[model samples]
Each structure stands twice: as structure tokens, then as C-alpha cells.
Target: MTATRILLRAIALALLFLPLAGAAAASCGDPATPIARIQGAGDHSPMAGQTVTVEAILSQDSRHQGGFQGFYLQQADHQTDSDPRTSEALFVYTRRSLGEIGDRLRITGTVKEFHGLTELVGIKAMTRCGREPVPAPIVLTLPWPQPPETLENMRVRFEQPLTVIDSHNLGRYGELTLARTDQVNATEYLEPGPSAQLATERQRLQRVVLDDGHRQQQPRPVPWPPGGLTADNTVRAGDRFGQLVGVLDFRFGDWRLQPQATPELLPANPRQPPPARPEQPHLRLVTLNLANYFNGDGDGQGFPTSRGANSQADYEHQHQRLLAALRAPNPDILALTELENDGYGAASSVADLAEALGPSWCVVTTPGADGQDEIRTALLYRSDRVQTSGHAKRLTSGLFRHRGRPPVTQVFRAKNGDTGVRITALHLKSKSCRGATGADQDQQDGQGCYNDRRVRAAEAIVHWLSELPAPDNLAGTLVTGDLNAYAREAPLEVFRSAGFTSMVHQLQPCDARTCPQYTYRYKGARGSLDYALASGSLQPRILTAATWLLNADEPRALAYDGPLDVTSALPWRSSDHNPVITDIRL
Candidate 1:
């Protein structure tokens, strides 16, 4: 054969072998790195900042609008290593949907750690070699047996049912916190100490958030709980869900699940009606924190008041809801907190509420005794049911001069000629740390800020009640309103040290099946901030007491100012704290 003919034959042979060489390089059997090696046993990648080649299958495509601006890549099932400590997956920040799910591809990029997430960015080359089976998701449960970093960026399925522990962020972030079981406030059960600290830590391990896979704020059509969220359809904190399939991820200092498919919601907690009135013929009393019930200048003009409502429309909605809630229990007297400090005029919040109740409802006048705080505790009673005996008194000395709302006390006699009873309405300093100092700051125990102030207020209340002159043969003395303290807190201990007793605890002790009763929920834990404590004389006369599950268990999205429009007249979420209803034989 001629020289030119031989050269042409060699060229043809080289073309045939070119594909074979490319296949060998793309196999990632030799110089290229395994995904598990890059995602070492530690939180970050061992090959961080280094450009290297990797072969994997695309597991998730999330490069659409409102997505995480990336996709997930995981080692094929047959190719992943058996080392359970190391992750066999990574997040590829492509900023574009380059490949379909289950597409096996060879890629060259620099490894980067973005806010604790190991990702591959600045891609230099990418080639779709062939299709591969996506890795099967590993089952996981709360109180994880090992550090979740071991399964970082890998698909996972929850084995046990998860309870919705918190929906506070449901409207803002479209995320719901899920836990192994319902979480109660540590201080509500155990006194603030080493035991409480341990319990708080245990609660942290059992919880994880289920994110909607989007980074947008206030995502439209709140994603979880099957149906879109509405005033009627709500996902409460105690609801349960199962069959959660997602990728374990860490962002914003929380370990969350970016769901692969919709989870199944099991409604363990349903909306309940207000507590029914006891069948026994006894006087009924209710203590409720109005949650800053400011009437915005009381008329129709003032818009955006200091606290409660932002507009006249919002104020009207709040007023209507509060009326519905107060009328449900059919209480003869109301001990209310967080009412607007505006005076007892016809347009005042207290007067408006009392007038709305009926023609016989009357406000217990304090004259010049109300405190300087923007909000004060007020008392109202039905004139036809109970008659006021003496003047109303308030404690303005000591801590109440500035910090706490003054305690208002009054004596009332039943219209049927029964013996007189003394009742005091008081609201203590809140847990807010804004102006807290000295002994009032957070002690890092289960109890929040202002423990000292609350304890002092409790002592003052007990002393003030003792000093006040009472009618001869008084039936009993009852202290009621928002104490701003849980059952096991220092303030409650002070009251217990005295002769006072919790009426609710008398009927439903903490040892019962439901254990500690909660009237408020915060940061995912439930506890009571409102109470009805009776003196030694009144303890035995207490027929029954219950914390009406109206407000705390319901979602804030159903509130007057929330995203929902005007619809039902139900008093589901009239306020942040639920009302405590008690019946007494005066």
C-alpha cells in the first residue's frame, strides 16, 4: 500500500478509539474524586476550594423562581460507599436547570461551602454520560441517633409521625415546626434548675422544621397541611403528620426538610368550642388578657393606634371577636388585662365592652386609682347579677408605681342577698427584656426575663389583699388576671407559700392525664400566663375551673389583623392568651 493510504487508515483508527478514551476518562474510576470524599465525615467538604471532577446522578432540580437557585446531585446507588458517617451527596449551585432527574453526568467544578452547605460552583465542564438510578432515601426519626450532618444533602423519609409543634412562622416563611411529640414549657413542669435546663435541651433535639423548598417570604398559598391555609382551615400546633419525604438540609441555624412530595396530615387537634358553663348554680368568673385591646382613640377617626389595631376596620373586628369570646362562657364578672388605659367614658374600651354585653353590665369604677401604664387591668360585672358593696381600691406603691399594672380590688354581693365576696384584678410585669435590669434580666434558667419583678408583684398582691378592709362575714377572696408567670415559676411559688391556691389546679392537678394546663404558647412551648387563685376560704367553694382552649391553640393567621378576610363570627383566636373560667359558690 502507498504511504498516503496508510496515513488515512491510521486517522480512521484514531477516530474509532477516541470515543473509547473519552469513556474511560468520564467513568471517574481514577483521578476524579468520589462525592463521599468531598463530603467528608465533618460538616464541610475536605476538598473545599479545589477544582475536581465528579460523576453523579441529578436527584432534584430546584433552579426555578423562588427556589434555592440550585439542584441536588447524589452518587448512584451502586457507586456510593458503605461508610455511613460520610454523605454521598452534594448541592450543585448551577443557577440553571442543566440536567433532568436520574441523569448520570460527569462535571468539573470548584467546591465551596456556602453558609454551612457544601456545594459545587463555577462549573468548567459538564457532560451527560448516561442514566443512573437515584439513591434510595434513608429513613430518619427525631432525636436523631447520629449527627444530621452525616446525612447532609441526602434524601430522607421520616419513620415516625411528627407533630406540628409551632405554626408561628407558617404565614411568614411557609414553614411548620415538627417534633416527636407535643412540647410543653420546661418551667411549666419543672422548677428553673439543672433539671429544667436538661429538659429544654432535650426538646431542642426532638424538633425540626419542614420548609416549603422556597426561599421567598410570605409564600402565597401556604404550602403544608394539604389544603391551602384559610380562616376556617388551619394547621394548629398540636396537629400531626406522617410519611414525610425530603432532603435533610441546614439553613438559618435550623435543620429542615425540603419536601420532595406532599406529606400526610393527621388532625390530632381540632378546633374546640368555648368551655361550657357548669350545670351547678354558682357565680362564674373569667380572667382574660385582652392582648392589647386598644380602641384607637375610641371613635371612628383614629387610625393606627399605639398597640392593638392598625386601622378602624381592624379595631372593629377585634371588638366583635372579643364580644363573642366574652359572651361564650356567660360569666357574671370579667377580670380583664391589657385594656386601654383610657378613662371610663362612654367611648372608653371598658365602657364600650360593658355596654356591648347588655344594659345591665356595669364597669367597676377606680376613679383616680388606675396606673400610669398604657394598659391596665379592669373589672366589669353584670349589675343585675351582682351588686357592688364598697369603693374600688388599687395598689400604686412599690413595683406597681412604674413597672407593674396596679392591682384593682372590689367587694361584690350577689343580688339574691348572699354574703359578699372580694375579687382583685391584677396583671404583673411581662417576660419582655426591653427595660429589664438587675435581678429582672433573664437568668438562663427555664424562666424568662423579669422573674424577680413578678415574684415581688405576687408578694405585694398577697399583702395588699390582707390589708384591705372586707365586709363582715365575707364569703371568700379571689385574685384573678394575667400573672405573667407559669405554674412552676417563682411567682406561683410565692402565692403557694401564702394561703392562696390555684382554682384550676384544685380540679385538674398537674398529675392528671393532660398534666400541666396551658393558656398560652410561645416559641413552640405551651404554658399558662393567666390564672384564678382563690384564698383558703374560697378553695373549697370552687366547683370547677377550666382554661378555655380558644386562643392559644389556634393559629395567629385567624386573628383580626391577620391575612384572612372577614367571615365567621367565631371567637377562635380572639386574643393571644386563652381565658381561664372558674365557678365559685359565693
Candidate 2:
């Protein structure tokens, strides 16, 4: 017989007995061999529920959920003059204890019948090839030919043809699993079907012909499984679903079958909206980074020291003074830097302030460790004046240095409802080193080494600010912090270049007389380092910017003046640096 005639006869015989084989396999005892070798079964008896082992090349091992892994093994079981019966089987491991991909291993499992399909279960073990992961294959683009009325189950051809082993719907999307040949990787081709007709045609020609000419001429009719599509003819990669000439694997859970090509009705496309949510109205937001509110001696000899009686008594005095200074400004949103751990704990200090300030304020503080308290940068806001939105983000950069906690960022909504703006509070690296020159001098100059970290921090903030979507109304943005770097520093210039306007520009130097804006004092030389900066869009509405010299009148010039009296007296004795305040109108 000619090869084509032999292929046609073998296909006809297999199709006629396939249903009977499945039924017999379904009734076989556990571990019973299913469909014994053609030569081993003299009478062609079906083997079901049998434990059968077959050796073949490992085509693919894909991992899914449940720690369960699956793979496909293919071997040429029967070859004829016309066509070959390539036995492609699916195997699954209930326990995910298999070796890596591309490893050849002997899998022994029970053959089970699933809806007229055969599967290997209870995978015993596997061996590894110890190979590194290969780079993904390059995708092949081809023209799709033969545009059909609708594209359901149509076997369309492509220039880069693929052997379709399985196709099914995972929810609303269609999934196709094809065997990867030397020219293609099976996993890479699992993409959406091509929409272009020319691309489909090019893909169809890429496939290799499976049957001889004689077998192709005398094709056997195969019935569709349940709602399966009819096989009018063989299909290739680029062929339309309904057209014959391409083989398709119909997947239903663990059971799958190679169904002949058939026409399927296309469903209507549903209109959908884009994924973005509607933005909220813009509002004016301000963040204040109050300078070192240390409330301790300049010598760092306050708590746990013999400087004044007991350490606990000194801490109590310091805490009261800190709270008093905080109340004077009464800022809508306050970012307090250099908040001491208070010897008690990070939580205690925050809680004490929240309680003393009443329930209108919320405080977040970082704790300390060892003998030193965790001096953190904190955020305290008036709950009634601002609505907290997102979680606070901690920023770390070269400018901020690795010394203390990173700058914290939080978004707030104005309760007044005029403009909604995002606020960032920062405390850049400080210049406290006594003696140094050159770069060191510049560092001491507030625009050099010390300021370098601050500059980096500022740059980071600028980058973050750039990414935020602009509000529809161009709501003003503010970046307030204890910059350590003076206004003339290049880092400050960087901020200006990035669209920030300084509030200090509106104030005069204190000079001899105690000025309302001088926040720092070194050997009676008063200077301003604390600042409030605004975005260009909101700078014009700044009503007034001034510093309240809370502790300026103290005779001794001590850092803090004991405990603060919240009602009667002001708390200028809290820290060496005074509080800077600003009022703005939208």
C-alpha cells in the first residue's frame, strides 16, 4: 500500500474504535493498563484504570497553584505509510515535588479516564538537567489570511505556524497552548489571536503537514464531543476556526481531546470604560517642618544625667516646655522634627502631647533605643482642620544623610474645602560640626557637605512632586522643612529652579534687634534656617510670613525654660530655635 493509503486506513481505524477504547478504559480496575501497545494486545482490548508507564520526551512542565505541577509528554506510538499516531499525553503531580524543566525523568502513575480522555496522575518523581533558564524566544510576526465572517473556532493560518495542542477559555479570555518546535517556544505563542487577516495567512503556511497526500484525500469523519466544533478539514496555525486543515486540542479541566476544525459563533464585543478613577477637587495644603524643638540643654546633658537633680524630673520639665511651644503656632498641619524619645518612649511622648492638646490633634512619632531615645521627625495635625488621606512615606537620600529617621510625607485634605494639596515635611542634614575647611567649610556654610544631603533630599522631593498628577484647579503645593541650608545655597536654588518660592524672601534679617523671623541663635548672632516654601501657583496668595520669638526674652538664653504653662505663659523655653508661621489665602 502507498504511504498515503496506509495513513488514511490507520486514521479511519483509530476513529472507529476510539469511543470503545475510552469506555473500556473507564471501567478498568485501579492500576490497570489502559490501551495496551498495539502489538501487546492481540485482540485490541481496551485497558482502563490501569497503571501504565510510557517513556517520551518532556515537552513542557508548567507550574500552577496548589503546589501541583503538570507536564506533557509526547512519543510516536504508531507510524504508517500515510500518517503517524503521535501519542501526546498529559500528566499531573498532585504533590509539587518534580525537578526543574527540560529534565528527563521516568514518571510512573495510574491511568485515569476523564470524560473520554486519558491522563496520568500521582506522578512519583523526576530528575533535573541542572540547566540555567534560557532567554525567552523572539516572537515571530506573520500575516493572517482568510478573513471570516466571525472568528470563533476558525483555524486561521500564519507565516509562523504553531501546533495547537490545547485551546480553552480562562474566564472571558481565550487561551491556546501549542507545542513548541525548534522554531518556536510553546509558552511564548499563548497570545491573543491576530486581528489582522494578512498576519493570519502567513502563520498558516508556517505549519508542517502531518498526513500524507493519500490520507488527506480520504479523510474520516469524526463526531464533535458534546458542544465541540465539527471537523470539516485539517487546520493550521493561520487557518480560521471553522475552516478544516488545523488540529485543535479542546481542554475541559484535566481532560482534553484533539477535535477537528469546526465553525463557532462569535460573541458580541462589550463596551468598557478606562481603569482610572475620577479625581477629587484640589485644595490648598501646607506642610511645616519645625526646626529642632529639642527642649534640652545645648550640651546634650538633659535626661539621665546629673545636670539637674533626677533625670525623670528633668524630662517632665522638658516635655511640658515642648508642648507649650507647639501650642503657640496652632498650625493646621505641623511637621515637628528632632522630636526626642523623652526617655519614656516614642509612644509616650506622642500620647502625652495628644492628650494635653486635646483630641483635636493626632501625633505620629518614632521611638528610641539603647540609652539614647529615638529622636524622630513627627507629624501632628488638627483633625478638624485636615483629613488624612494616604499612609505616610519615609524618604531616604544622600542629602538627608543616614543619621536620623527619613523625611516623612503625608497627603491631607483641607476641611475648609478650597484647595486640596499634597504636603511634604523634611529636616535636612544639619551643620553642627565646629572646625573644617574647603568642602567642609561649605558644609558648615549650610550649602556644602551638610547641605549636600539636604540638596539630595530636596531633589528627591522634587522628583516625587513631579510624578503627582496636577489638580484640575492648579491647587497650590508647599514644601516646608528645617533645611539647615540657608536661602542662598545652590540646593535652595535647585528647589527654586524646580518651582518652589521661599517665604523668607518676604522677611528682613533680625540684625541687632530681635527680628520676628530669626529662628536660630549662635553666640547671639541670630539667623534664619527654618523655612516654608510654596509652589509658583500658590506663592502669590501668601498673606503673611513671620517667626514668633517664643523664647527670645529669656535672661539666661537657655535652650528651654522648664515646664510650659499652656494657658497663662508662652513656651519659648522649649528649644533654641523659634517657630516660623505663615498664613495664606487661596
Candidate 3:
């Protein structure tokens, strides 16, 4: 017989046995193998690589364009084997779109495991026997009582509330990492040791991704938060939801929930306004990470600079947002990090920013003092509120000579005859592991790469500030900017051991499970990378310290790169890191 005749004969035979398959299914007897038996009680299928016939109900049809190119089959109600240890559902992969949910299907195909998902492919025969009741969705909750593998490919409903811990991939992949509660960085609370190791492992068990059902990237209308995603309407990391009805699917190395019904999201963490200016008469200092402020030649021509904005329009928008944030606190001195490393010329980025802040604002600069890195730390003071007491100093020797950016220190005095207070702006080596070597590489202790270098930098900052000439060292000192280390990390520990108190910690203490205050958010975890640390002599003078919620909590979709996503000209999300404001009575 010809190939086409053989295929037609097989289809006719499949149709001939369709009624028998339905009768056996209704009687809970099978000419087809039981799905649970095929699944077994293990991660891999016991019937893999074997051709088998199965009668099941269609639970999900995903054969449309942008779908998963397949359909899900589950054993009909009251037809499942009495085993909770094995899933009773299987994914049927085929190009043909056939049958609706609740339609009973008798299919013969080779059972195979496709990238960890147990599925049937290369079908030889398929027949829609008749309609059968859809399988009841199994109820599941966070902190799973059983392995997800046992429930894999089954229709499950999560009724307990799940917190949205990570939304970083929401815009790109249409996925959200949800957990039983808000998750924190291990090193943010516990020291790097056995305790931290346990915390990290616990975090892994608590996570499950919520997928948008479609398998495409950057879905047309971003899903979640009930309505589609917009510049102003966002699904932030801290949002909460009570219920989710979906299929438990494992794909791309993560166990995800492909929702059959839209989950209701609650705005647990809402957008907050910029902090109000302090009322008491005091000297306010603000430390901010510019998130790499680079002006292309300080003109409108520099497109696609090394670090920051990619275009002239992007650069202007970033500058405008930053200015709004800077003006909100009405700070007397600004310790800034990640400014362009250009010279102190009239066309420099710092000069342009200073000019924008009015004539009373002037940057503390020494000719040829800025480091050779692409970005540097800077100190800008309000000339009307305080006067420069001594020449600005930069530390260029030791580890900072090549490892980290050189820190700039400037001593300032209140115009009303208050004592001088020296402030040092610092930007340490980041956690990126590219080209890291020896002890500087990630030790896997949760401190990340270049931690040893950052610890050495912290020590150097302490010693360098103490060794400054006469009047510079005589004044009370405040060290502030992005340390690129969490609260309990080794770098911050070095500063604490040196008697420099963390102003934010002194204000609001954190425990092992919860940290309410943070200046940065990464991969859905919140921690303080930007801090205001004060020397022993300066601690008592601090009146209040706060991290304004202008940046970290906001969505990145509102950033400068995507102009259509920019809804407002407000200071929210002006930078990736939030500004830490400190009020001190000098």
C-alpha cells in the first residue's frame, strides 16, 4: 500500500476504536495505559520512549499562534488512579489543533520527555471519542507539602496568598516570581555563614514563577495587575494576591503556574511620594547614586555614551528627573556617585548640573583629582548654606589605585559659625564577577565578587579620613554614598568595627526575617547599598536619617530608555538607587 493509504487506514482504525475507548473510560477500564502509571512516582517518566495509547480529557488547548504549540490532557473525573504521588496529566505535542476542553480524546503516540516535561509526540493516531467531564483542579499552597514534580502537568489552584517577590522579568518574559512572603537577601540580614546558607536554601523552596500562558517574549499587552501594564500602573515586587488557578508546569528550569483564570492582584505596596523636607533648623545632607550620569560631550551630540543614556533626548530626561529629586530634599550638601569622569571644565557634567541648581551650588573639585575610571564620586555643596572649610582631598594610593574609584572628601562649615563637618563621597567596586581574580572573586558567601576589595576600600576610607592634615581630620566626619554592599556584609562590617555608625540602622533596626528600609532593590530582593555612615564624633549630631522612596520601589519601565513608558516628569525612578537623606545639627 502507498504511504497515504496506510495513514488513511490507521485513521479509520483509530476511529473504529473511539467508542470502545470512551466506553472503557466511563467504566474506569483502559485499553489505554493509565496516565498515573506512565508518570510513576519519579521526576522522569517510567513509560518514556515507549509508544502508548491513552484516553483523557482535554484540559488546555494551546495550539493557537504564540501558544505552547500543544494541548494538555488529564484523566477524566473519577478515572484517576488513587495515587497522589504521581500526576494524572500529560502534555500532547502536535501541530494540529483539535478538540476543546472537556472533550475526551484517545491518542496513540510515543511517550517522551522534552526538556524535563513529560509529553507525548509524533502521533500515529488521534480520535475525539466524545465529551467527558473536565478533571477537578487540585488545590495547592505555598511551602508545598509535597514535591512539585509529583503534581507536575496537573491542573492546580493556589488559594493561599502569594507575594510578588520579583517582577524584574515581567516586562521581558511576562513572568513573576511569587513566594509565601516577601523575600530578603541572605547577606542583608544574616552574616555569611551557616545561617545565611540556610536562608538561601529556604528562599529557593519558596519561589514559583507565574507565567502568562503564552510562550512568546514581550507579549503585546503585558499581563498582570488585572489590567495591562502601563507607565503609571505597575505590578511591583511587593504586591500580593490571594488566589491563582492554573496548571502546574515545569519549563525553562523553573516550576511555573500557567493560569487558566486571571489571578486577582492586590496593591500591597503602593507608590510613595518624595519625602518632605525636614522642618527643624539643621544641615541636611543627601547621598545619591546618579545611576551613571554621562553627558555626551556635555552637548546634544553625544549619542550612546559608555554607561548611561543612549541618546541626547534620554540624557535630557535623566537630567530633568535627577534635578527634581535633588530639589525635593533641599539638601545643604550632596555626596554623589557614578558621575561622568570628565574634567572640571565649564562643559563638564558636574558643572552643568551645578549650573542647573543655581549659582549658590558649586562642586568641590581639585584639578586632576578625579580618578581615571569612567565614573567617579563627587561632592557638591550649597554655598549659601555652608562654606568650604578646606581644600577637597582625593585618596589615590593603595587598593583604590586600580581596584575602586578614588573617594573625594570635602570639609564644610555652617554659615552661622557651626563647627566644620567633613563628608567623604565613596563608590566602591561593584559585584560584577567579570575578570575577577583570586580573593577578589566571588567566594560564594553571599557577599558577591570584589568583596575583599570592597572591604579593603572601606578600611582605606577609614584610615585615609583619619590621616588627613590638621583641620580636615579635626572636624567631625560623615562617610556616605554607594558602598555596593548590604548591611551585614563584610564591607559594612569593616566600617562598623572602625566605630563609624550606620545612620539608617541607628534609626530603624532590622531583624533576621524582615528589613523594612532599603535603598536598592535587585532581582526582587530589597537591601541597603547606599548608606550614610558617621564617625563617632559625628553620630550625636545626626538628628534624622531617611531613604526617600523616589526610586527603588518604582518600575524600571518608567526609565529614560523607553520614552513612551515615561508617563510623568516627577522624580520617581530618577535613578536605580534611592537617595539617602540625613539631617544633622552641626
Candidate 4:
């Protein structure tokens, strides 16, 4: 053949066997477009709903039965541009396996945005030609950044040791919140306002999630926290982990790290036993959230009455769990919330609990009214240790009637001496944004919903208590209950402004103590939503204020109503909020 004809034949043959779907370098063939261009410097996919060919290395594969049904694809080379606002990766949705990590392959898919995540759907999988080096991860240090837009959908590594601040969805979603250190309430440092806004921003900048590298629901054994979480082997907020390396994924309205592999846990903050009594002569007060204690019926026939237990057996189980928690602390006074608002009639909630605790326990009756609400605050005391010295007082004015459960207070004088303390119990509006409106809506400042209402209710409580006549021999006063506000929240600020100091903060400051400093874990961040604010008089008398890890720290499967093998009558997972115990000398 002629020299030109022979060269043309050789070129045509090479084209036929070149592997069209392979992700070879541009010099070898027509290389696919880089992934960074597809994911622009915004919250959306630049080529949404459009088909595009891209060559990339798979960073994560969660296509297991219950996972995200796909894998994360990131740029394999150091081809990232100087613009720090753009993403270097994207999620590819598919029903089958595409390729393994470092395997370079060309993918043809339609770009789409799912909820808050930018991904590629309708993916056409291709076989791997050869493995390419995975891109180096972005180093995220402590105090991440106010805006993480630039790092979204990118592989990153935690430069600092990140502690698990919240693990509410550990069992359900296999996810937990990680922070530079143990997390705190924004409201605790400053009330919800402009400063609260700044603090909230700081917290957001400091926190990120460490998600189980799965997208499925209810993975039998949660993938994170090392071994599966248990009652005794619980994972608390202060629990620390080694340096983290994962893909930064933004979904469900938050930034999360889909870890490449399970990192070893430090177990620095494990489940702890109830604190021992202090040496000083004092009264032990316990404030617990019942997680919605609803008695089925006065005669135990009311299965699935309204909220809590689903059946008679469930009620019995819940009762046993709560009873264990209340008595385990050996408390002289118990401030409880979310109890069944069944009246003081026979077989009522209080009567049942009081009977279970024997004759020594007596519940303070609130005149003739049990406010018209599904749940209410309650006070119970060991009559042998202290006797009621004044009539019980309940708040009943204005918004307190609707948004706030009327706080109940009573004076208790020590049985053997004149020293006494008055206690007020309240349940404030929750941060849930179900029906939030106006200023009550979440301001996205880290303080959740209903913050404004909680602030207003706190004002009422402070005003009412200021006017309350001190009963005989009262040496101090304590305002304890579920403020439904985190530390530094507006409501908590109101209480602080009214001269009430958070006992937990006074005793165990997060900066000073390695132990966890939170009462509730929501979503994935830990903070003190349940509080025991003491007056100046009571604050000094306090010897210790601590939270018992009966709940929140442990997984939901350990609850009384959870699955059989893990369920029990133990105090673990008794409630959603950890019970706060205060040891004080009146």
C-alpha cells in the first residue's frame, strides 16, 4: 500500500479499539470534561437536567441495599482551579456498582439536585480502564468557616480531633455531629440576639457531621461510633475521634462527612454511673424529662391513649424504666416534665408513680387545676426528708396559659431543721418549628424554633417569681425544668437576667471539664435544653450539678419500647433528655 494509505488504515484501526468510555488522559483520546466544571461555585449544578460526560475517580460507594443507591465521584487529578468557591466533586446516583476507589471511568448522566444535594441521576455505568490516584483531601481545621460553600461536595480531612457532639440519629441514620471540641449551647454564652447570631455562626463554622458512609435507613448495626452503641457502651458528646478523612456531602440541610472508612473511637466519654452524694449536708434534687409519659388509662386499659406508650405492656415498661431512673439517683425532690396530665384522681400518673415509690414520696397537688394541656410539669418530694411548707403556686397568666405550661412552685422546709428551699418547675415551648410564626420561626442562628416564645415565657416566670412571697424558713430558690431552650438561648438569657444561674454551667464548664456538658442531644449537636437555674442564694449552696447518662447518650434501641433484645427496665434510654441531678446544702 502507499505510505499515506497505510498510515490512514493504522489510525482508523486504533480508533475502533480505543475504549470510548475509558477515562484516559487528554493526550490519549478525547478526554471527558472535568467534574469541577459541572459543579460550579454555587449551590446548584451548572448543568442541571442536562446529559454530560465526565471522567472521575469514585470516592465512596454506598450502593448497598439501604445506602444512597450510588457513590461519590471526585476529580482524580490536582486539576482544581484557583477559585475556592467551586466544588471538586459530585454525587452520582445509580442502582448498581459503577467502579471502585481510584478506578478511572467515563460516566454519562443527567445532573440533578436532590433536596439540598447536587448530584448526577440517570447514570450510565462504565467498566474501569485503569485506577488513577485519588485527589488529596481538603484539610478542615478547628473553627471550619462561616461559609462552607467552597468545600461542599469535596473530599476533606479534619485537621483537628473532632468529637462527637450529637448522636441522636446514630441508630436511625448512622450519623453524628462532630466539632472541633465538645459543643455548647449558643444561648448559654449569650442570649438569642445579634451576638447570639454571631455565636451561632461561629458554631456552624466549627461543626460538621461524620456520617456513616451509607444512605440507607435503619442500618441494624450503626456503622459509626466504632462498635454499635449500647447502654453501658454509650457514645456521648465529649467522646473524641482521631483525625477524620471523608467526602464532604451537603444533604438534609446540613454539611456531613461521608467517611471513607470507619475511624477508631477514643471512647473518652462513655456511659457513666449516677453521681455519688456530696459530703456536705444537703438535699439532692433531680430534674428529668419523661420523654412523654402518657398513662394508657386509669385502669391500664387505655392502650395507645395519645402520646407515649403504645400498649398496656408498653406503659408498664415505660413506668418501670422511669421508676428506676427516679429512685436510682436517691433524690429528695424530683422536677419532672411531659407526665400524663391525668388529674389527681385514682390511677392517675402521679398517683401511680407515688405509689411505686412507696409512702415516703408525695406529689404536690396544684390547687384544683391541672392546666388544659396534654402534658404538665410536676413536683415530687420525699416527705420524710422534707415537708411542704407552703401552698403550691402555678403560673396562669396570658401566654403562659397557651404556649407555656404553668410553672408549679412550692416551699419545702428540711424536716430536721429550719433551712429550706423553694422549687419551681416549668416546661417551656420547644424548638420544634411545627407551627412557628413571625419571630418565633428559626432565625438560622443555631438557636432552633420557638425561641421568641420561650424568651417571653421566661420573662413571665421571672416576673411572677419576683413577686412571690417567700414561704417560712426559705433559705434559697431554684427554677428547674425543661426550658426547651439551649444554653445561651433567649429564654435562658431572660432567666440569667432575672438572677438565675445555670447550675450545670456553674459546676461543670465545658472548657474546664472533660465530661460532657449537655442534657439533650438533638439532630446531632449537644447542649443543655433541660436546666436547673438557681437563685444566687441557691447557687452558692450547690455542691454538684450533673447529668446522669440514662438517655440521649445511648441509642434508641435500648429504650423500654424499643426492640426486645435491647429493651429492658433499666434506666438507660429512659427518656430523651438526660436527667439533671443537683446536690446542694440548703
Clashes of each: 0, 65, 0, 7
List, residue by residue over 280-362, the lDDT tens digit for candidate 2: 32232223332233434433345553232135445555556666666655566676666544533433545555667778987
Task: lDDT for model 1, please.
Answer: 0.83
* lDDT per model vs. reference: 0.83, 0.43, 0.83, 0.77
TM-score of each: 0.92, 0.42, 0.91, 0.82
TM-score of 2: 0.42
Query: Which residue pairs of candidate 1 clash?
Result: none
Candidate 2, superposed: residue stretches over 4 Å from native:
1-310, 341-346, 364-373, 397-404, 416-418, 434-449, 469-474, 507-516, 552-570
Predicted model with the maximum TM-score:
1
Candidate 1 runs further than 4 Å off: 1-31, 511-516, 565-567
Give the per-residue lDDT digits (tens) of candidate 3, residues 298-356. 87877799998888878888898899889888888999999999988888889989999
lDDT of 2 at 492: 71
Compared with the true structure, what per-residue lDDT tens digits does model 4 show for residues 9-50? 999877754433332333322456566667777778777877
List the candidate 4 regions with Cα displacement exceeding 4 Å: 1-29, 41-45, 48-52, 56-59, 72-99, 108-127, 131-139, 145-155, 395-404, 432-472, 486-500, 508-516, 536-540, 561-565
TM-score of 1: 0.92
Locate the minimum summed-lDDT window of 10 residues in model 3: 20-29
| Clash pairs for candidate 4 | 66-216, 67-216, 187-487, 187-488, 187-489, 188-487, 188-488
**CA shift of 466, model 1, Å:** 1.3
